[model samples]
Target: MCHTGGCCILRRNRAGRRMTLSTQTTAPYPSLARACTVVLILFATAVLAYTDRQVLSLLVDPIRHDLHISDTQMSLLLGTAFAAIYGVAGVPLGFLADRTSRRNLIVAGVLIWSVGTLMCAVAPSFAMLFVGRVVVGLGEAVLSPAAISLISDTFEPKRRGLAVGTFFTGIAVGIGGSILIGGGVLDLVRDGLFAATPVAHWAQWRLVLLAVGLPSMLWALLLLVIKEPVRRHDQVFEENLPPAAGQNSLFPILRRMAPVFLVVAVASMVDNAVGAWAPSLLIRQFGMDPAKVGVELGLLLMLGYGGGMLAGGALADRFAIWRGRNGKIELCCLAVVATLPAAVMINSHSASGVMFAVPIYFALSAVVTASGLSAILDATPNRMRGRAMAISFFLNVAIGAGFGPTAVALAGDHVFGPGAGLGPAISFTVVVSYLLAALVLAAAIRTRRS
Candidate 1:
């Protein structure tokens, strides 16, 4: 009897040991690999999108000069023409992202945007160019929602902020590179690189656009390398987590996220308004040549906004991690608090002061704050991420990127007019926008925390 009891205890111990080993051995799964691969693919997509958009800003004068359009018209091209279609497409694409093959959809979107970019070079009239811009915007509509949705699925709740931030690096580099490349190309054109080329008569600027726009086709191939992650359910926690909070229906989730959505929209609008109008204002006010403006302002934005983007993401991740120990909401609130002061500084007195403040503003601008987007996704279920992101994109892009530029240009046209001092007026408009963004962001923080 004693021997039998000892043998039984040993058998139970061995069984427990085997269970632990089995769990440990199976822990490393394909999801992690899929996450890393998809993030890189999404990053490339972002790079392409940003670069294409930036090219327009750099080539704005050339396009304007050649087409004989007004400042307001240029703004329309940047804002409404692009934003209208882009915003409209986001909803349908987002719905598709939630329901269908996100990977294939993104690949197709990339192809569409690439074609749009290339078309911008060949467009013969203002109307045709407008069509190309619209196409570009529409193609871009697919990127953020789909990529963010995938990232939300790939990473655990705690890691989503960093993932989102990392994904946004394409934004930083894309815009920064656009400014840099635009300036460099302008210099090349000014120096007569295109003088001997085939399209020597084709404005050097048009040539530049054609060159920058075509390379993104290569990115279409990159999509093939990405593997879609396994979709998660409300239940079936892999790490012994409880069944995650389930997704609400579309209407319910929209209502819950509305307040935050409003704030993001206002903030984005203000940010875009400032970004679009600034370079033009600088050229008009400072007496800086276009090529020179491209390089200097480009570097300023690069270091200030782009670097800030990188820093903001890291800060948000660290803050979220520290606060995630308590709650993600509260920590995100703290980030809003920290960014508020920077918004005020963006309107500081001196030009140098403003330049210094820009990176701070750009940093605080939801690039890092957007890391919380994943938290929103986590709060819901797998199926809702695309729609939620679509709503966010619609509000953010439609209001921010879409209207912001138009508003600024219109204000510059009406209030400042063609002959009036443009620089200070434009600055005033942008400053107001940044302040409003701060207020909206603060409100968003409160809403998120609550």
Candidate 2:
């Protein structure tokens, strides 16, 4: 029989002897106030990281024009150049998070990526901008593994879903804020708001980059105040026996979690594709002003994506109570299924139709994202979470960030014949990616049950 005070289970051996095995439990978690403060700080860091990373989405056209690059070339900047290094570096950084002070790692990451963002602001050519993005990727790579690991260690099992959800809301805010702020700044620049400043001579896009990148340095200093939590040894075992073969290694966990990784990959693929191109889609297809699109779209994303994240967290916690660990994965599957209609609607003929659809798509994707992350934390042991999350980040950046935008561009340039076909191309990417995610998530749930 199992007891509540300590995680103990009774098992019968082949010799007909019953044994009780107890997994190690740590001291009580940090106080709720402390945990909340940690989450708030981490959430702020996440916002800064993503804002620096994604602000480029709003600068695509001006950058393309200034650099004299094609959409395919620009897509390389948006996806491959950054993703390649980010994904590759994440493995080592993730392992480091497992062994080192995650707080210090994040502080360092913030400084490096902030410099990278500044580098992008002054980049004179496409090559330099690509290099800058690579630096940003390198720096930002430290975030997820470290942050998620920190969250898992600081909170108990049941409350992790909400904590993780709150942290990810930063992502929603960053993504939305990138466009909202970028658009507002761009509009202000065009209206001569910066005419008196030395930066008035710079192009609007460069100004936007400068505006977004500078604050991250100050944000890094704030992270210094976040005291690192004590590492906890939290692992659940189904039976009492010798440690399973390869238990200490990450490969076993990776192999078991393959489906979950795929779900995140495909979901990220569509999410990045939409984020990278939606502005262009609005401007080209609907004849909307870039600044106008940025404000409206940005507002919609913040509300939709942000709301979805909170809801997902709450639902994840609720599902965990109702359906055990698998509930998180079940939530992911449901979100993917619901995303299909939203995906189709993003390609609506009228601008109003597309506008209405945008929030729905973003909101649903955020749901999947929040629940999926919680599932990963739930499935991985505390000691292994940093590496596990690193692997997931690698897949997310490498496959989703590395390939998603480029795939859409290639399709638009080649299959869809450029200008006229971008809307359809985005629709195709979202629909196909989510379809695959749905199937994989369903299989994961079934496997869990078996």
lDDT: which candidate is best? 2
TM-score of predicted structure 1? 0.80
Q: Report the lDDT tens digits of candidate 1 across residue range 1-450.
A: 111111111111211221110111112335666777777778767866877776677667778888899777888877778888888999888988876777777888888887887788888888888898888888889888788777766776446667777776766655555676778777876778768778778877787776666667777787877666555432111122222323235665466555456655765676676567656655655555777767776776666666666665566456545655214344444445555566556444555655566556666564534544534553454466777788788877888778877877776668777666445454556556545645665666566546
In terms of lDDT, the poorest run of 10 residues in model 2 is 237-246
**Superposed model 2: Cα runs more than 4 Å off:** 1-28, 191-193, 237-247, 320-325, 447-450
Per-residue alpha-carbon lDDT of candidate 2 for residues 124-154, written as tens digits (9 for 90 to 100): 9999999999999999999988998899788
Which is the leading candidate under TM-score?
A: 2
lDDT of model 1, residue 252: 55
C-alpha positional error of residue 367 in candidate 2 after TM-score superposition, expressed in Å: 2.3
Alpha-carbon deviation at 263 in model 1, angstroms: 1.7
Deviation in Å, model 2, residue 353 alpha carbon? 1.3
